[model samples]
Each structure stands twice: as structure tokens, then as C-alpha cells.
Target: MNKNKSEHTKDDNYLKHVSQIDQVNFLNFRRYLIDWYETVKRDLPWRKNQDPYKVWVSEIMLQQTQVDTVIPYFDRFIKQFPTPAALANAEEDQVLKAWEGLGYYSRARNLHAAVKEVAASYGGQVPVDKEELKSLKGIGPYTLGAIMSIAYNQPEPAVDGNVMRVLSRVFIIEEDIKKVKTRHIFEALVRRLIDQKRPSDFNQGLMELGALICKPTKPLCEECPLQSICLAHQQKIETTLPVKSKAKKQKKLNYYVAVIESPEGKILIEKRPSEGLLANLYQFPMIEQTKTDCSLLSEYLSAEYDTNLNQEQMLEPVKHVFSHLIWSIDAVKFMAQASFIPKEHQRWVDKKELGDLAFPVPHQKVLRQI
Candidate 1:
């Protein structure tokens, strides 16, 4: 299903039940959700203030990524690109490098592209309205709703997985959660429930409820404040409220790197092809294999760099994990020749300059020794 562009869809008949919702009960649930939020919410830095830039960055990074994984990356990225203008004006390669290991390189690329336009056209201020926000690259319905409600105090609903799960259970929605129709139906329900007085707190509070209390597995139902109103909770069907298909397993790869170095302090690194995994990133010259060793590593480079690589110069094996692939790399060091040719795709840099350049995760690890 090509769910690439999700317009602010309005399914009137689908959400007819929402118009008749009991406001008093919804407000009680809202208060309970917010009360739970104040004490139990995760101590994320972005939540500390009401900056659109910070909230936008956090939302962008948190897409399809775990909260714990994004926390450190978010901290580091905000330290580097503190504002919309900072990120908007920065180099794309630098942004992607900073976004390394987070996966989904396109998010970083599209974000950079969109903000460049924002800086030029919108004076670098993130747009407040959902329509304006949607015009930017990579900013979809959820992102727009998030920025609108959380950053700008708009009374819109951000229907993410967590919120969907919680809402589906509260009203006992039985439709397939994977379908866009199901989510839109729920969003209309929450949109009217949003306390126009405190939309930010209300929306984030529901998100908070789902994340901490009504989790996907082994929900702390005892701690949930919406126990009285949640139909799933009363019926003991909370786990099955938001039904969806199983996730597809990511394919795995066993990649190896040959980190070769020369005697005079220069190191051999190659730029990855301009497409596919880790595209446009730097890596140590590599030898692809199902399995490998020092002997194979030496022979692989015989014609390319030099066979003068000493066995003692070789560092121990190193490994890195991407979502699908497992990369295993062995570092091999060499004594330099007086004059060696650099290939079109390869570069020989002063080893000390590795830090200055953006090496991918695996190459960055090999740099500690080589």
C-alpha cells in the first residue's frame, strides 16, 4: 500500500459516533491522562521547553526508531544544530554524517532539503499550521499534527502508534489499526477531545499514557488512570485493542572491511557508491566475504594498495550492526611506498584527519587503532 501522501482526510460518516461523545467523561479521562503525564513522563530534553525546532527534531528522529536509541542522538544533534536556521543552513553531508547510524538516511536528506527552503522562503521559522508544515519535505500528517499541537498549541490530534493503541482501546475500536481509515476515524475522535485550552498537554499526555502505562506488551493496566473509561481495560482486552499484522524481518548481511594503513601516517579509505546502504559515506577499503582472515585480507590488497602490509600492523576484528546487516571488519596496516596512486573512488588521507572527515560507523571504529 502506497501511503506516501496522507492528506488531512475527513471521513464524516466514519466518525459520526465521535460527534455524540460524552464531553464530561472525555475531560475526566483527559485529566487522568495529564495527571499521569506530570509524574510518569520520560525525562526527554525536548519536553523541557516549547520550542518548535526541538520538538520537530525529536519527532523527526523518533520516527520508526526506538525512544532510547533516539535520546542520545537527539542530544548530540541538538548540541550541533540547535535551531531551524542552524540545520537549514548546514551542509547536507554534515547533517547526514551527524545522522549516521540512525538509519533512514532519506529523513535526514529530506529534512535538510525542506529546511533549506524554509530558511530561504519562510525566514527559517518552522511553520505553525498543519497545511504549511505539510508543504515541507518529509513532514507528513503525524509530524504536522505534532508540531501544530505540541509546539504551536493547536487543538489537533497527533495519531501515532502509541496514541492509536491507547485511543483504539479507550473506545474499543475493532477495525484494523494498519488501515488509514481506522487511524483517521480515531484522529477525529481525539481532535474533538483536545482541550482547546491545553492541546499540547492533552495530546502529549495521551501519548505519555500509552508509552508508559498502556504499552504494547505487558501493559501496566493497574497504573493506567483511564481504567474507568477504557473499554478495553474494563473488558480485559487491552492487549488486543490495536490489532495489526506482524512485522517483516529485515534481511541480514555479513560484511567485512579491510582497514589498511601505510607507514608514513596516511590511511586508505574509499567512498561508498552513490546509492543504496550508507550511500555517500566513507569507509575503509573493504573485501566482501562470507568469512575472512589476515591471509585473505593481505591477498585481497596485493594488486590494489600493496602486499607490504605487516601481519603485526593488522588490528583485531571489529563488528557493527545496522538494522538488517551485521558488518565484521578486520584492520590491516601497511608500510607506505614512496609514491602510490590513489584510485578515483579511494583517497589517501593523513590518518590524523579521520576525525575531521565523516567516517561511517564501522570505519570510525577501525580508526581507534589504524
Candidate 2:
């Protein structure tokens, strides 16, 4: 009985907090945001249409990537995979090739898999219903809400980091935004504040406000449409309201890269394992070290390639940071003996052929230098 009472009281408190937002105030909030969005939204390619396939591709590209970076890639990808059927029919390498340099290769793989299902099952049209949309692989709550609201104009709330930041500042929510529980609170608030008539505009407006005005630091509170009613701004604590815990330190690793060029001037590249980091991407052969060192490269080349490799030059170290790991790569140029043979997953390619193969950004950088 005591436990039930405690749970009920907690739910009551949550409801009470949300109830503080009156109907009139909520309407005014929505009105101001929609009005502001109409005047000042970014002229994005995806925003020009209500096509769900375009929206889905743009959203996936925008995950952990910036808008400016996504625009060209989105354009090129759509041109290549104009429909679900196009992506479904295309080879995996072709899909990854289109998505090269975007990072998070898994998103590309999942999108490919999901689009194949969409082509076969949904007849190349993105599903309209929320539950059906959720059933697709890689389509989570946020993506589902975004597609439903933006493309379908449903009264679904697209609560991403931008939306969370905007709401946390507007409501003066002091809860840690990093916690999974906190997202539910923000989602509920969005449900209350979402404009029924223009769900797409309203959701986009909130995200736009966060991206342009209610920023992480030195927020342009004066420019925000919600400035008048924003709790954080009203309390003069806008910069400090949406508190998020810092992420864990990335594990540092050292990789000694071997750029082996055969006597005929073709470079040796290998395909990464089908699983794990940089899966199925092409790169020069490499040996990881406990710390930054180049002595192991000679021995590794002899044992792995069964050839004597003369290290021509040791270039400057290159750093590539992922979400959870930092790669400190030392690229070494080596000349493979003429008798060297290409092993499994390894092939010799000229510069033109290298361009055709999809190499991760770090490898691309080193290739340019070599």
C-alpha cells in the first residue's frame, strides 16, 4: 500500500508540473513559434517537400552530423537512391559508397536493410501510421515522430536534442537531460505544446529555435520567440538550465598505417571485416599499437604480407575521433616487393580505382598526403 501510494504521488507531481502550462499560454507559445518559423526557417532541401523517403534519408544523415554537412550528401544520395526501390535494388557497396565520409556506417547499413524491406513490403512508400513506421528497422521513437509529424502532418512530437534543449530552457527543467527518464518528461511537454493544425511547422519551429537561438552557450535569448514566456530566460538562467552530464572520455588508440605501393604504382588496400568499427570500409593495411610507435610496422609487414617492406617515410600523426574512441594514426609509406601477392580482402588499386572504393575519412586524408 505504501509503495503504491508513493508511485501515485510521484505521477501526481509529474502531472501537476505539466498542468502548470495553461491552454491559452500553450496556444500562444505554439502561435509565436509557428509564426517565427514561417519567417526564418532555413531553406533546406528536405523542407521543400513532404516526401517521407526524403525526410527519412535526411534524418538519418543528420544523426550526429551537422545540417551543412548533410545537405550535399542528402542531395547526392537522393539522386542515387531516389526511391526505396532504388536503394533496395542497389548493392551494399553502392549504398556505402554514397554514404562515405558521413561516419556512423551502421546507419547506412540499417537504412539500406530497412529500405529493402520498405521496397518489398510497403511498395516503396514510407508507412503513414505511427505504429507501422515504428516497425521499420532503425526507425526509433524520435525518427517515427519526425516522419509522422513532418511528412504526415500528424500531431506527433519530434523530440530530439534540439527540442529537448528548447523545452528544458523554456520550462526551466533542471533534470539531467542525459538520463533516459528525462526524455519522457520532455516528450509529455511537447505533446501538450504541439500545435494540432500545423504539427510539422510547430515541431520544426522548436528545433529551429534551439538550433538558432536557445543555443548551448551565450544563447540569443532576445531573438527567441519563446523569450517572453521562457522560464530560464525569465529567471536569467538560460545558459545554465539544460544541464547535461559530460560524456565519458574516449579511449585513445594508436594505429600504424602501412600505405604499400607496388612497383607498378598501384596502392594496396584491404576491406575491413564485415563487422566492428569501419565495417566493410576499405583502408590501407594497419597494425594497432599500445601507444604511438613505428618500429612494429616493419615486422608486421614481413609476417602479415610475407614481403620485405622498406619504409620510405613516416608522415605526421593523424587523429580521428569517433563517439567512443580516438584513433591516433601514424601513416607510413612503404614500397612492396614486386613479388608481393594480394591476400584475401586485399587488392591493388590505382588512384582512380581508389576513388571508386569507399575509404573512411581518416584513410582518405592519408591517401591524399601519400
Q: How accurate is candidate 2 locally (lDDT)?
A: 0.85
Superposition error at 78 for model 2 (Å): 1.2
List per-prediction Cα lDDT, in the order shown. 0.77, 0.85
Clashing residue pair totals per candidate (backbone < 3 A):
1, 0
Cα lDDT of model 1 by residue, 146-239, tens digit: 8899999998779899998888778777778888777788777886678888889888888887788889878888888888787777788888
Please list the residue runs of candidate 1 whose C-alpha ends up more than 4 Å from where it truly belongs after superposition. 1-9, 13-24, 175-181, 290-295, 305-321, 324-339
TM values, all candidates: 0.83, 0.93
lDDT tens readout by residue for model 2, 1-370? 6975875555555545443355237877988999999999999999898799999999999999999999999999999988889999999999989999999998999999999888888888898977778988899878989999999999887888999898887777788889877777777677767899899999999889888888888899878888888877887988886889999999998888888888889899999999999899999987877533467667677677787878889877799999999998989898877647788888888867888878898998897887
Q: CA RMSD for every model?
A: 4.4, 3.7
Poorest 10 consecutive residues by lDDT, candidate 2: 15-24
